[model samples]
Structures are given as C-alpha cells and as structure tokens.
Target: MTGKMLRGMVITLVLAGGLAACANDPSITDTIDTRSAPDGMKTVGVCYNGNNTTRAAVSEIALKACPKGTTKLKLWDKDHMANACPLTKVNRVVFLCLH
Candidate 1:
C-alpha cells in the first residue's frame, strides 16, 4: 500500500476509536425522564455494564443525580423493552427523585 494511503487509514481508525470511546461513556448514556414525572419528582435513568446485575452501580448514579433522596421505581434493559429489576444485560435503572 502507498504510504499516504496507509496514513489515511490509520487516521480513520484512530478517529473511529475516539468516537467509539466517547459513545460508550456512561455519563452520556444516562438519561432523565422529566416529561412524565409528576410535580416535585423526576425520574433518573442510569446504565450499567452487565446484564441482570445488582442495583449498586445504578443506585450510585441515581444518588449522585438526586443528592437529596431518591426511590428506585423500576429497572429495565438498555432498550427499555421490559420491566425487570436487578437488570438483565446492560441494565438501565429508573429512579424517582424527590425534589
């Protein structure tokens, strides 16, 4: 392969890697549900790495978001396809934050 072509390929790979790293950041993955929340309460969602995992990781994220207090309402998979707690594979925790 030509030197210039090889360099271009390396640059493309590096840029792709950077983008992938940014996309996987947990902070960016978390979401908040304010649209459906009742007055004085907000819903916080956090993602975990493993499926069917404990609440510890997500709980920490919720607590950080709430600061005052929070109540875990439900847990679901990454897609929010099912209502399951202690999530199964790519856990996304939903918590009710009191405001």
Candidate 2:
C-alpha cells in the first residue's frame, strides 16, 4: 500500500476508536444493582466516567433504575475505584431509592 493510503487507514481506525469510546448521552456504563438494604430500602449501584459524565446524567440513571412514582433517590455512597465503570476510568455513585 502507498504511504498515503496507510496514513488514511490509520486515521480512520483512530477516529473509529475514539467514537466508540464516547458514551451516548445518558448512557449507563456501570453495573446497576437494585438490591434491598437491611432496612428494606431499595438501592442501586451506578458509575460514570468522571471526565465526561455530568451530574444530571448520573441522576437520570438512578431515576430510571427506581420504580417511577414510587420512590425518590438519596445518595448513599460514593467512591472511586478501578474497574467500577466501563469504557472509562473509575468513578462510582450509589443511590438509595426511598419510598
């Protein structure tokens, strides 16, 4: 292949990879755990890429996880750890669904 062709291929591949890394708006990239806490409160485990995620987006994830019209969310826990969020570095936020 010519040098020009090779460079074009490389650029295309790079662009494709970059696009793949971008999360669709409001996309949830972490595990969604809706388990009952000891007090019977509902909880969800969610994470986001701190570099690109927004508070509203994260809130939307939690809202969608809970049963609509039945519960409100309360932040229960938060931390940063490796492998917590997919497609990006770690940042986790847990919310409790309160009745």
Candidate 3:
C-alpha cells in the first residue's frame, strides 16, 4: 500500500480502538446510604461495580452492615426500586440494607 493509504488506515484503526475502549469502560460507582431508615428500622446503602458485582457479593456486604444478632428485614436497591436480589451487572448498585 502507498504511504498515504497506510497512514490513513493507521489513524482509522487508532480511532476505532479508542471508541471501543470507551464503550467497554466500566464506570461503576458503588455506595451505601443509611440516612433514609425508618424510625425503628436501620438501613444502609451499598454500591458495587457493574462489571463484577454479584448477588453473593452484595449479600455479603449487607450482612456486614448490620449487627450480628440483628434480624435482616429486607435487602433492596434505592427506595426499593429493584425487586431482584444479587442484582445484575449495572453501572451503579445502590443497595439498602435494613435490619
């Protein structure tokens, strides 16, 4: 191939690679919020990365939020929006742990 054609191809390849990297970037943010608990219920918030967050992983975090002897009443995400437990691979997982 001519030098000009080769240069153009290289630039195209580089741009494509950059776009792909951005598309697959894992911009996950996990957090825990305990400010919304009811009068008697203790609540905690947890966030996990979407690429590796699993139900088991979330449960483990929730189990740690509450005291050992306390009863776990519910485990949900942000205002009980998600009904599923051990949530899917999401960009942000905001779990509310209640005891």
Instruction: Identify the candidate with maximal TM-score.
Output: 2
Model 1 lDDT per residue over 2-94, tens place? 999999999999999887654443331444432355565556676554533355655666667764545444432244534232232344556
Poorest 10 consecutive residues by lDDT, candidate 3: 83-92
Q: Considering TM-score, where higher is better, how would the candidates rank from best to worst?
A: 2, 1, 3
- Expressed as tens digits, the lDDT of each residue in 1-99 for candidate 2 is 999999999999999888766643334344344334557666676667777768888888788887666457788777666435654546777787677
lDDT of 2: 0.67
How big is the positional error of residue 99 in model 3, measured in Å on the Cα after superposition? 5.5
Per-residue C-alpha lDDT of model 3 across residues 27-74, encoded as one tens digit per residue: 223333323544555454554444654667666666676556655536
lDDT for residue 12 in candidate 2, whole number 0-100 = 100
lDDT (Cα, 0-100) at 87 in candidate 3:
36
Candidate 3 Cα lDDT to native: 0.50
Error in Å for residue 1 of model 3? 29
Whole-model lDDT per candidate? 0.53, 0.67, 0.50
User: Any runs in candidate 1 off by more than 4 Å, and if so which?
Assistant: 27-39, 48-64, 67-90
Candidate that scores best on lDDT: 2
